[model samples]
Target: MSPTSASEIISALLDLTAWTVFDVDPEGRILAGNDESGSMQLVEIAPDGTRTQLTALPSRCSGRYVPGTRRVVVQHDNGGDEQMQLSLLDIEPSAPPADLPAGLPADLPTGRAARLPATLVDLTPLVHDPAYKHDLADVSAESVVFLTNRRDGVDFDVVVHDLATGAETPLYDGGGYLVDAVASHDRRSVAITTLSSRPRSTQILVAGGEIATSPTTGTTGGHGTTSETPEPHTGTARPVAVTAADEHAHHIHVAWAAGDHALVMSSDHEREFAAVVRVRSGDGVPASAETDGTVWETLVAADDHDLEVVLSPDGSAMVVGHHQDGVTTLAVHEHDGTHRCDVTLPDDGVPTVIWAPDSSRFAVHLTASGDPGSIHLVDAATGGVSTLVDGRAQIPEGLPISLPTVHRVPTPDGEQIPCFVYRPAGTARTGDENDHAPYSTTGNAAGTTVAGASVVLVHGGPEGEANRLFSPVIQALAGAGFTVLVPNVRGSAGYGKRWVSLDDVDKRLDSVADLAALRAWLPELGLDADRSALWGGSYGGYMVLAGTTMQPDLWAAGVDIVGMSSLVTFLENTSEYRRAAREREYGSLEHDRDFLVTASPITYLDQLRAPLFVIHGANDPRVPLSEAEQIAAALADRGIRHELRVYHDEGHGLAKRANRKDAYPAAVEFLTEILGR
Candidate 1:
């Protein structure tokens, strides 16, 4: 039989999906985002790793198990507008599945013994404008707290709902923007954090029923859209300041700690890096509380590296995740930040630590170089690790899996760029498997010695770092005989703030120079530099355009996925909720139009000589479909070879499984045709 081909790898990847855990119940049942039927839905994973489908929502849904009840509160939205609506799912054993929600595919399997039957209850009816974005903040047995932008489309406000009475109460409209909210375990009070005073200060609002307020106008009760002036009610809410007004502190509320008495958060006040701090959760009546100030104690101090904290469910322990040069290091400590111990893992990548209800265990979505990602159970007390779900289980047996080697490629600016190099494995073309001819025939082009066609894969989030993880696309390319290099360039997260901020605003082009340097460095690693291409999504997509345009002679081809073509236009016509945040990374359209145009790839499209392929979602709210359209139009007018794919059902990225399957293989085919590999 022939060896597995790139197409086979892509097909196998289609059947694979990674689960992101949201919450865990006392019974050890976990609520998570999973793709059981090609669409993301809520799934309950038993303590033993047994999987059970919970909801058949048409779109992606994030869920949390309601304490002491058989209920799960889920947040979902229409298409990909990100305006989520809250829904309740009664996941009791005897719950009937009759009268399922409309638009649920008729072909969905009716019975799965492992799955508890569930009934969907639309909670959106409690809010007036379901058109605005709503997010789940916290859930208790009797009530649920959510943040919504229904009142003003710009800032989010806190809203609490009683599960039993269906009574909705507006809590804390202290105005600015609500960053996050966490309900106390006793359900008597809630702590809300506002980031209105960014980069310098923050306010923590603690409120109870005494401080609840609901607007008198715009009560749509899930029906008409008559905008009425909501009679605002001022509750006895007490505001606690975490940082001084003059300090450059950025306070981010993380979670409720030590029952309902305190909260855990990250504050960069008077420090270069953000550190964890535990603040007093004042009594419902703030005037009577005996706390000296808002901040009670510093749980974790800011060290040389930035910190990410994950508190145990019982608030007994905490996990500190920090990164250096793109690899993550996790340390476990007591809830009070004592007794620290580093977690021993087999590989290095960003592992999201989700603590179980008992605080004795944690589930980590672990990933490594050449491995997509998998869910692993970690012992909180002993720092032990074990696999719960193997994300690569979908790969066929006997296929040669590729692994990456870390290469420290030095840049021109005295920086060492960490690059993960994945090479194709060798296989016997005929007869016994022991016959070790290079597994792929595609790489042995003329004048190449033991080297393969190369591709530089850039990751998005100029603020995000690339980690060693299993990516089907990278595997497929390697299987097709290409040497794939993924670099964590400047402006990537996980590498301290200074490194991440290197490409911000006017310094953006320096990262493009690093891309060019990577191409020049490829030959030293025995990879064919002349036969290489550039591919990335989002910011990485933007890198692809930049590399192909500014360093046209360096790349054989380029593929851009939902990348920005014109920074100025993107800022001018992106979703209002995201425009300001994006402007911070890319220059602002209002004040820095000329700077944005200078940084944009569309401005230098005439310099691009290589063939290009672009993919985008028509309804993308961030990058928008116009980014792709404009580039495709420009390339066409210039007579450049290119192909554009616009998926109607997708937004931001190719999130739909069917769309990914169709899009990825087509990408491989395009590279094959253009690079002749």
Candidate 2:
């Protein structure tokens, strides 16, 4: 048996198509996004497995079908800037010519030809500013609600656009990053979540009644109105406080429940993990319900694991996605907190649940280390699962697909760091089995080999988790005969809230130290200790650079993709709307500039001994391209061994297949040359 070439492995992996179902209508039609056309595009999947491509553009797109209509509200951006904008795409068929001139054949082209070609109607043309971003929140039969910073390019205000009248109304004006908002069943109320300066802490607010009027013209104006007398009222609406200001906790995945109730997955009431809680609509804040006269009911307890919930369209049942260790388990429950049945997925991987309008069955997008990604229809009643879309159909036989083994590395403290280890094909177990006890691997367990080289792949977010999801880069590295270790460091999520905030602000370097810990423990897993490299993107990229500099001797090489070299510069050059939210995690430049400077990877550039490969997106709005340029420049001036590649057509990460095919294989080749296969 011979090892697969890097290009061949990447090409086969990149060719794999993963379908993510966005919206499912009552008629069993699914609106999904798949990269079948080289970039992610919206497609409509009929009940009979018929797929109709609805969008074809240079950039990737995601959208949901407008409820009770043939229209779809598409969210897309220029290049990969992340400043998303909304557009209207009507899928309804155009009427044939009433009287064909001297045409003998009356039957026009049927099927796809009978339908009008999809064309995007730009909804934000009045405020088409790339500096600001507009994110779709919720869509009703007659209106679309979105969060945008077009007003000041800082605070995100929830704006409601009338579908028929085109009149716009500013529904809410909470002074924070309005991350999510969902409309009630009646469309008279909206529940929103706002992030404060604290990490993972979000405040939930409910704005009810017709408090604001619609504007007739300007940025707030609709595309065109049919009403003779349009109502005047287009500004920001004040919201009633649901969560108190001082009671800080992580609240997310807000959904409208039965009646005026709202379901939120929150870590409130002194809980370490988030649980689904039902908040009864009222005038007072629900956080102080025990002391005050409000009602806060815990529908689903966290039970030692963080949970995410998605309510059915009809509000009869909900799916709770439980996160334990690195894998996920989804369970269904009744609206009244009754445990219905646990959804059985194809494999133990991460699943994103999207409910059908009829609530009969829901679609689950499952992805694991071995499985690329596939959409399955799970019977809500029986928990039986069936494949709806096979994402791995294009993967050629004999392709090396690595399934990760879960292991825990002990820190200097009493904490155990979780990591996913992937070894190359045909590797044999060499170490004593009891050396690292209690480690489990998904699918068929493969023997671990004493590899000469390994790659430590870090996940971004610092607040993010490294799960058992399929990663093309990891597979490529493993195919190239390198052991891959993906560690969920101290600051990573999926653990409790305390674990996520361990490296906040001044303590940011503690996460960098975690790399050192992982490297020291690598030999126990039958991996070479001195030949480990670091690779990550965004914050993970930051980790790569930080490990190479702060812990200079720990890594042999480093690959930083859109990572921040200097936290000070990152905070200074980041988008205005992102600064405050990021400040809560990293220190603020206003007060903690010196500390941020000390924690930056660039601050220790003189100590860096590892060769570096830098990749960045020119249009990245989160971590600006300057972050990449500065580090690359510093390395060049010092005559260090390094290379930088900037993609003009991308943002934070590679979205197009062409760029990924070029970049990732090149990265593998670079690492192989440096690490020695």
Candidate 3:
């Protein structure tokens, strides 16, 4: 079946769940509405017609209601957090006409309710509920807008949504998935970061007139031109100044937009800086002056950072959030592109930045020194920070600052890998965290100079890599007195595409070797080369299995999280949206069967000698729970010492605070017991 015409298109198009099905009579009144989709989680309407809401809803009595249509059209799928509308259903006249609204347009579709398309509801046994397949790290629906990003290579998009009709259209067309995309003040245009395929190269694309299209779903409205290639309205898409420095400008970020200007910021991946760019119909204009750079170089290389800019709605003020060395920096800059005030931070792992509409305040996902992760709000002028989401102490008790020592370990190759390794300053054998430290019979892991126990961290995405996100999980282990090392390895993103694609098929084992090289480097840093453990979740989890099996004698224990115990199971159950991408990323499940089998960690179950902890989210539609079962059953058959923790309600990554809490301490104990101080 054609990809576009695949019977699943409707649900795929409507996947977000927040959509509307309705008909607008030629008279401009909504004659009827199908049960609101997507918005089910957002609004609760009492049987009596009263409504309670999770997000702001659009006014039903308001503007932009298309004149009339019997033909139902899906208009927006991006408005999950706010009120939205889909399209008009062509309702048949039941009786004599009432006086129509004088402002209603006369060009509405004929008066007839159309039958639902047979292909609308996908009846296939294999179908993804009309929701995003890629993990949406964040979702926003306000002012009829939705923006999202994935751990995958897909570029981020900011969609204009009409929840009333479940229609969403992209605001613009090109660039790598952006970390942030937003609209400008007038709502006449939008300013956003361009996540380009190049990863390092980014551009600012100001949309011309609506292109006669839905900015979210890209469905054409009469305002859009007939051209396939989008062009600026009047050759006005000006290339404004993006950055003053050119040190691998990978994480270009747009904090916010307002007026006709945008507050744009960029970093060297370690320092924060900005520019005030004026937006034209299709391009941007740059304001003069540049702030002295602030600290950047977050967890991994500057290239691994997600974004650095956040601006006020009117693009008047902004902040540049970045990290340098092991510290994160938050810099507040004046909108006219003048001077900036900076604050340096440590323990706040890597941060995700969001801004208040006026740019007077901002927020970040914090990874403070204590180990629990958190989300905090900050005053741009005062530079004061307050926590919104506190760190949790295991799932049972919640606190955000207690998160992990999530960090990026710079490898000898100049590449940075995600690593979580640290022991309390002088905890000796044990502390409040855990006992014996993970993988520390005597000393730290291979990379850091610290004398703590060492834990080698692996990221889940063989296509993904580790970075500086807060992890109470890592902190608990460190508090227990162990060191962790997370390697971006081969398949991680934030880097160029080639770096990510390097691990596919024939080169699968190279990552295993990369870990080995890292292992050999631990001694150089004065960390214990002997005291080390391998652990990870998802692809990272798979790394635990692969790394341990590839070099059984190299470490002490292994921890896997929703990892593929067997590549066979992974290939069979992997979500369809991810199927083609994985095949292209790794190897064909059918054609390259042998290579896949060889790469399967389950295939080498018998060689596994260390105690292992396997964790899985039972509802994980991507890597099904069966993967853990197969590996555990195999381990059981062989009488291996391995424990499995299953979270029934969670999906791919741990969502509930409780799940994260449980998973962390359990992982610590398992690793420490096997590694032995």
Query: What are the lDDT scores of the predictions, listed in order?
Result: 0.69, 0.76, 0.48
Q: Of models 1 and 2, which has the larger lDDT?
A: 2
Listed per model in order, the count of residue pairs whose N, CA or C atoms clash below 3 Å is: 14, 2, 116
Residue pairs in candidate 2 whose N, alpha carbon or C atoms collide under 3 angstroms: 166-222, 213-233
Tens-digit lDDT string for candidate 2 (154-240): 998888877777777778866688888876655556677888657767777776543223322111001111212233443455666
Q: TM-scores across all candidates?
A: 0.83, 0.91, 0.57
Instruction: Count clashing residue pairs in model 3.
Output: 116
lDDT of 3 at 398: 21
Error of 1 at 36 (Å): 3.5
Please report the candidate that would top lDDT against the real structure: 2
Give the TM-score ranking, best first: 2, 1, 3
Candidate 1 segments exceeding 4 Å error: 1-3, 93-130, 174-179, 185-239, 244-253, 259-262, 266-274, 279-304, 340-347, 384-386, 427-451
lDDT of 3 by residue, 531-589 (tens): 78887888787888887777888867888888887676787787643455456556777
- Report per-prediction Cα RMSD to one decimal: 7.8, 5.0, 14.1
TM-score of 2: 0.91
